[model samples]
Every structure is written in C-alpha cells, then in structure tokens.
Target: MKKFFSISFVLLLALSGILAGCGSDEAGGEAGKKIKIVAAHNQTSPDNPYQTGLLEFKEVAESKSNGDIEVEVHAGTIGTEESELVEKLKLGAADVVLVSPGFMTQTGIKEIDLLAMPYLFDNYEHWEKTVDGEVGEEMAKLINEKSNNDFKLIGYWSAGVRHYYGKKPLEKMEDMKGLTFRTQTSGVVADYWKKVGAIPTSIAWGELYQALQQNVVDSSENSYPYFVQQNHHKTDNGKYITETAHDYTTRFLLVNGKKFDSYSKEQQDIIIEAAEASVKAEREAVYAQEDEYKEKAIDDGAKVNEIDREPFIKLAEPLQEKAAKDMGAEDLLEKIRNLK
Candidate 1:
C-alpha cells in the first residue's frame, strides 16, 4: 500500500509539471515556439510598391529572427479595402496593416486627416523631411494614445505624387469649373476641389476602372503607379494627364500596439528593424515606378501636360489654415509649412 501511494504522488507531480510547461508556451514563451505575424496591404498588384514594401518587411523579420518569427504577407487577400484592413487590425485578426489617412480618420484618429490635405506637401523631399522628423513623431504618439494603444505607427510610406487625369486637360484653374471630379467627397480634399469649381464625387477604388471606362465620372485624380496599373489612363474619360502635383501622399504602416507590447523585447526590436527596411524599399519602388508608369501612360497615348501650379497652391492655403485650426493642429501645420 505504501509503495502504491508513493508512485501515485510522483505521477501527480509529473502531471503538474507538464501542465505548467504547456501554460508557459501559451503565454508567449520563446522556447520551442514560433511567432506568426499577419502583415497585409490593400493593393493586389504584384508589382505594387505596397507589396514590395511588405515583402521586404517579411524577409527582414524572418531572416533576422532566424525563422523564429514568420511573417505572412497578404496583398488584398484578407482585406481589399483600407477600412477592412483597419477593422482587422483593431479586432486582432491582423497583426500589421497599411492604411491611408482617410481611413485612419474613420477609425477616430482625426489628426491623421491632416496628412491627406491637398497641396499640403510641395514635393517628395519636403514630405520625407516632415514625416521622418518631429511632426511624424508627434503624429505617431497621438495615434497610439488616441487609439488607447490599439494602434502603433510603425512607419510612414508614400503612395507617390498624385496628379490629375481626365477626358480633357486643364490649362488653368478655371477649366476645372463644372467638371465632375472623382475624389474624396468629404473633408478638406472635397472642400479644395469644390473651391476650385469641380464637383467632388466618391467612388470605390475597385469600381473606378469601370467608372472611368463607362464615363460614369468625368474625371479622377491619382498617382501614376496606381491609376496606370488599373489601366485608368487607357479609358476614354481618363486619357488626359495633367501634373496637378497635389498631395504628396502618406500611408501609415501600423502594428497592433497591445500585441507589440506583448512580444518579447527581442521580437519587438526585430519588428522595428523590419519596418525600417520596408520604408526604404517601398519608397524606392514608388519613385522608380512613378517614372516608369508615367512613361508607359504617354506611350499608350495618354495626353501628358504640365501646368503652372501657383493657382492651385493659392487656393489650398486658406483651406489648410482653416483645417489646421479646426483640428487643433495649427502648430503642426506651421511646422509642415516651414519645412516647405
């Protein structure tokens, strides 16, 4: 009887040890466990800058962690809309996501809308200086705090420079009068277009090709890589290209802050490094693709023209001031302007 009791106690101890080991693994113990990250972007094009950026992130993260951290990049796989991506990230369905300022504002981070203001940035050099500097840091902090750490801004990305394309070319600001423009129909972007005498209209990015082809909208605006890849310039309503040079665009690369905090310090470090690499790779891709796609559009018979931008700049200034004051980002606006 004594021998039997001793054996039973020993078995109980072993069972407890096994349960504890399982608990540790479940609690993010690095031993014998691999971390999986779901990184996503809305653009589905294989040659897209977003894809290049996220893949670079995957490579750096996996290689640096020696395969301990596995990054699975989904390009329009899990979510094709920025809104969907933002929702997934907040719900913990996605670990990392790329989103635009317009959608980010929809998530209750209104300060981000500042980045989407038309004519806010003069050129890519000015944009890089602002976002990689103090203004960017402030914005990131605001995002993390405003979202209660649900979002952590990991990096800033560009969607290249936006231009105007439509059925007809604009020789001056007055030419935009009475034109139905496809663009953000809300916020400062809409206000700017309206002030310039164009009627702002909202359309989904996916449906835009059909809209352009069918002449459902009279005109639209976007960067070269984006509209060109969609063959927008080939459409009857999209054949004319004017270098409006509005919106040196900005995209946010975000990770779930709560999830980031839960990771081991080493894992967090690897993620930051990966983000840095992605920013570099993505920007280079956009710059190169912009020139390539612009040339492609011209070769395909898309009319290309350049106009004096002083009129557009003049129109955007008052709106910028009013928007900055309303958002309580007057100081940030001043800083961005000073950079320019």
Candidate 2:
C-alpha cells in the first residue's frame, strides 16, 4: 500500500512538470515569432512608385532579419486620399505610409511645404543633396516633434518635376491667365498658381480624368510619368505638354512612432537600412521612366514644348518669398539652397 501511494504521487508530480514545460514553450514561441509590418500607399499594386519601394523594403528587411520580420504592402489598399492615409497612420490603424509633401504640410507641419515650393531645386542632384543633408535632418526632427511623435518621416522618394498640361499650347505666363487648372487643395500650390494668374481649381486625383474629359478643368500639372501613366493626356483633347518644372515633388514614407518604438534596436536598424536602399532604387526607376514617358506622350500626338524657364522663375520668386513667410519655412529654404 505504501509503495502504491508513493508511485502515484511521483506520477502526478511528473505530469505537472510536463504541463508547465509545455506552457512555457508555447509562451516563448509566441514571443519569438516574427513581427508583421504593414505599409500603406496611395498608389495601387504594381502601378505605383510605392510598389518598387515596398518590394525593396521587404526583400532587404526579411533577409537582414533572417525572416524575423515580414513586411506586407497594402498599396492603395488602405486609402486613396493622401490626407486619409496620414490620418490612418496617426490613429495606429496603419503602420507605415508613403504620402506627398503637400499632404504632410497640411497636417500643421508646414515646413515640409518648402520642398514643394516652385523651382526650389534645379535638378535631381540638388534635390538629393538637400534631402540627405542637414536640412532634411532638421525637417525630419521638426516633423516628428509636430506630430507629437505619432509619425516619423523616415525618408524621401522623388516624384520628379511637375509641368503643365493644357488643351492649348502655353508660351508664356500670360497664356496661363484665367485658365482653369486642376490643383491639389493646398494653399501653397493654389496661392502660387494664383500669383502666376492661373485659376486654381481644386480637384481630387481620382476624379481628375472625368473632369478633364468633360471640360470641367481645362489643364493640370504633374510629372511626365504621372501625366502618361494616369492617361491625363488621353482625356485632355489637344494636349499641350509644357516644361514648366514648377515643383520637384517628393513623397515621404512615414512610420507610426509607437509601432516603430515597439521594435527591437536590431529590427529598427533593419527598417531604416531597407528604407535607404528602397529610396535609391526608386530614384533610379523614376529617372529611367521620365524620358521614356515623355517619348510616349509625343508618339501619342501630344505636342511637347521646351519652354524658357526664366520667365516662369521670375513670376515665381515673389510668390516663393511670400510662401516662405506664411509657412515660416524660410530658414529651411535657405539651408536647402546652400546644399550642394
């Protein structure tokens, strides 16, 4: 009887130990699992610049982390409107996003608008130096501070130079007078157009095509690739492509601060490195497509003109000064101008 009781007690002890071991293993497994990060963008799959960056980030991050992190791109899957994406990031519904500077400026971080100021950058080299240098660092710091650490601007990706596309050829600023042009609903852009005597009509991008087709808006401005890819030239009958180069726009990739903070140091470093690589790849893709798209536009019977930029610059300088004052971004603008 004594031996039987002893054996039973030992059996119960062993079972309890086994159960505890299993529970611990399950907990550790759950803790050790790879993190899944979702990145959202305004462009649809396989068609947006965000697509290339998304792939690059995923490839680099997964490889560097050895499958400890997974990045899934929710391209155009989150929201089409830039403002909506920004709001989603703030609410923690989205982990990361790729959005335009114009949209970011509207969030009360107006210093970013300096990037959209007309002709602030002479070429890609100038733009890159400013973005990757001290000026960019300062701007990033300000953005993070302004957002109360809800959003962090990780890096910038270029959208190329913007130009005017109209139904009739515009040879000078005077020709743009009283012309109804579709503009982003940004005071900075609208005010700039107003200064040049163009009627700035606000329109959402998704509705722009139909609006142009039905003659609701007579003209618009965007990069060559955007103009071609969006088929803006097709709907705007008698398309006139002018080389106004009004703004060198850039898109920002933002990360939710809390989500970013949740990552380990190693994981954070991996994300940053991946973003840098993706930015480089994206810039190369953009440069290659710029001329290719311009050629396509010409082939499609769109008249392309290489206009004299001096006249446009003269008209824009005073407006630039005014914008800098209104947005309180003059110091950053000066720093950008000094970048090599």
Candidate 3:
C-alpha cells in the first residue's frame, strides 16, 4: 500500500510541471499563440492625428512580429471618454491609450498639470526642446511611479499650439476684461484667463459650437485644426481668432505598465520600436494639419490677428509659478522655462 501511494504522488508532480511549462509556452515565444493588444484613443475623427499614430503602431508591431503580435486600434469606438480609457487600462481591459495632462490629473497625479500651465512653451521649437528632452523623461518617470507602474508613458505627441478665438480680436490685454471665455474645466488654464480679466467658463468640446452660437460662452481657445474642423469660426461668437499662443500642448501615449512588463523581452522591444515610429508620425501629422487648417480657416473668412504676447506672458509667469508650487512640480517648471 505504501509503494502504490508513492507512485501516484510522483505522477501528480510530473503532471503539474508539464502544465506549468505549457502555460508559459502558450503566453510567449510559442507556435500558434500570439499576443494581441487593444490600442485606443478618444478622437472620433477617422483622419485625426491620433489615428495616424495608432495605425502606425499596429503596422509596425504586426510586421516586426511576423504574426506573433497583433494590435487592434480603436478610434473612440471603445470609449470617447479619456477617463473611461484610463479605467479600462487599470482593469486590464485596454492595453494602450492617449491622454492629455488635464485628464491625467484625474488619476491622482496632479504634478502632470504643470504641463498645461499658460505660456509653458515659447513656440514649437522651445516646446520640442522641453518635451523631447530631459524634462519629458522625468515627467514620464513620475507618471509611471505615481500610477504604481499602472501607467507607462511610451511617447509624447502634440495637439498644436493653442490660440484664442472669439467674437472680436484682442488688440490689448484690456480687451479680455469682462468677456466670458470658454476654456478648460479647471486647473491653471482657467485661472490664467481669469487673471487676464476674462470670466472662464467650462463647456464640453462637443457642445461648444451651440454654446457659442447662443452666446452661452463669448469666446474659446484652441488650435486652428481643432476649431476649424468643428467650424467654430462660422459662429458669430467665434469669428475673430487671436493668436494668444498660450499653450503648446502635450499628449502622452501610455500603455499598461504591468501588462507591458508581462510581455516577453523580444515582444517588449518590438513594442518600444513601434511606439517610437508612431511618435514621429503623429507629430508630423499634427504640424502639417496646423498649417493646413489655418489656411482653411482664413479662406473660410475667420479673421486672424496677432496680439502682442509680451504682456500675456508676464501675466502667466506668477500664475505658472503658483501652479507649479501647488502641484509640487516647481523644479520641473523651472527646467521647462529654462529650456526656452
């Protein structure tokens, strides 16, 4: 009876070892098994720059892996809400996503909001220097650390520089006084406009056209590509576009860091390559679209004016400093300012 029991225990141990090996084989570097990723962003437009970047990622990953890895790009089909995507990433339902700093703050990483401060970058050149350099690397590290490795910043992209468009063009700082300006929901953006004497109002991006048509908000700020694509210029309250150039925006391409770490080393390297390619493609798309849409807006009769940006920059300094201190990113802010 003792000999029979020993034989049965040996068989069970052998079987468990085989099963564990099978599990690893099925997950990585195995025949007939592939890693699939769901990549998503909240831009609904088929031609949006986010789509351009994500599609490139899918293309590169699939081509490099020779069918070992497949990426599915969901352009707002998965979720139009950045918040929803962030939640899905945490739940392991989504693999990759794009998000702005404001929405990122909702994840409890308020230090990221410093990127959204007014006059953060002097121009696209200064903007590129900051975000493509050491400052960007540190910010990416903070995101991953704060999220407990739930979020990994793969690459940085741009949404073009933001400008002010409203009922009338501003020739001086005093023009902003008393105007109801449509801006971000909160954070340093709203505060900056408020300091300039404009009453900052929050309006949903999709609902903004009607709000402007009905005078719910007298003015709004955005890049030419965004506002022109939505025809914000056609509205009576949006005809005059002033080049305030307050923000040179940054968007992050993030992946589920834990999921990323779970990937095989070869697969992880392939994904990093794909992300680098996508970043280049996305930035090129945004820069081209900025000029293309600006011309379109001008042809569509949206009056464009250049404001003296010096006073506005001066107004933004104290506000930027306060916001940086509040977010505990004062050093990061100083690095960015010095980058310009």
The lDDT leader among the candidates is 1
Query: If the candidates were sorted by their lDDT against the true structure, best first, what order would they fall in?
Result: 1, 3, 2
lDDT of 1 by residue, 1-340 (tens): 0010111222223223322323343453454357899999988789999999999999999999999899999989997789999999999999999998989888787778999998999778888878877788778878877998789888888899999999899999899999889998888888899999999988878888899898889999999999999899999999999999998999999998777666765676678788888888898899999999999999999999999999999989999999988989999999999997
Tens digits of per-residue lDDT, candidate 2, 177-265, equal 98898886456777778877889887777777788888999899988877688778887632898888888777887888666666665
For all candidates in order, the CA lDDT equals: 0.85, 0.75, 0.82
- Assess every candidate by TM-score: 0.90, 0.87, 0.87
Look at candidate 1 and give me any clashing residue pairs. Answer: none
TM-score of 3: 0.87
What is the C-alpha lDDT profile of model 3 across 227-258, one tens digit per residue?
88888999999999999888889998888877
Candidate 2 Cα errors over 4 Å, as ranges: 1-33
Summed backbone clashes in each candidate are 0, 0, 0
Model 3 lDDT, full chain set: 0.82
* Global lDDT of model 1: 0.85
| Candidate with best TM-score | 1
